[model samples]
Target: MEKLINEIDSIVMETQQITKQFQKGDEVEVTSHKLGFVGSYYEATIVSIEDANHYRVKYKTLLTDDQSAPLEELVPIGHVRPVSSHQLGTTSENRFRQYDKVDVFSSDGWWFGFISGIIEENYYVHFPTTGQEVAYPSHALRFHQEWSNDDWEA
Candidate 1:
């Protein structure tokens, strides 16, 4: 697993050197599973490229009937792959070793649950890595990392 992840990291770095076309006002198509934008792709902004190979996109979902209301608010979709430049984002932070617990967050800011057993078809979870078990579609999850028990204010 370590070797595979290292290989993936190298591929990411190589693609970083290539120039890609991304704009500020462009109607970006981000992949997720929400509503009109769920699974359907989202109209977002190409905020700015944080680095040579990375892009920063902001996604927002409006209420179905209420124009002024937002079914979901804006946060971060996250870093994407360089080869598939148009993808939204999903993060596999530092990574969780066996027995580590995690809290899964949906794009609209909802916590699905804590880490559970792994299955083939994403039963309780969706995309299951070695330690990270996926519960919802990539878009459904907006935030997930090791569940921190430390006090941030400390």
Candidate 2:
């Protein structure tokens, strides 16, 4: 029927628009109604786009090593605006400070680093091992103690 055709077209168009808003390698928050994720947001990597609306996402917090989910349940993190520090009834002093040692997660695994700077709620971490810089959300980082070059571990 013409109505069915129109609905399908609408779905396809909407999917395309949503897909355009995200890209491979972007971090996203995935929430699933099934099991433990019922009320939590999990950090994930947008591995690839399987179709207009589905994305292959690898969960950063998988209990086992390297588990990936099919495109059906992933949502881009950037789609949601982060709450400002003031909104949490906190101030800049209560947040992570510059040069603070922190552990950041990456595709390889969790890496140790220091907070170089902050852009909004995201922290720029400098990894001493490879001299690489990466940006991670606050949830993806943890407070850490300073480490020497010889004591570093990935």
Score every model by TM-score: 0.29, 0.35
Which ten contiguous residues of candidate 2 have the minimum total lDDT?
80-89
Q: lDDT by residue for model 1 over 1-154, one digit each (tens)? A: 5654453333222212222355555444344334322222343566675665455665555354556643433323332211122222344653323222223344442332333443442324422222334544444323222111221110
Instruction: Flag regions of model 1 displaced more than 4 Å.
Output: 8-15, 28-43, 47-58, 61-105, 108-120, 123-131, 136-154
Where is model 2 more than 4 Å wrong at Cα? 1-94, 146-154
Look at candidate 2 and tell me the lDDT of residue 143.
58
Clashes of each: 7, 1
What local lDDT does model 2 show for residue 87? 19
Find the number of clashing residue pairs for candidate 1: 7
The residue pairs found clashing in candidate 1 are 34-38, 35-38, 125-134, 125-135, 126-134, 126-135, 127-134
Indicate the TM-score of model 1.
0.29
Candidate 1 global Cα RMSD: 13.3
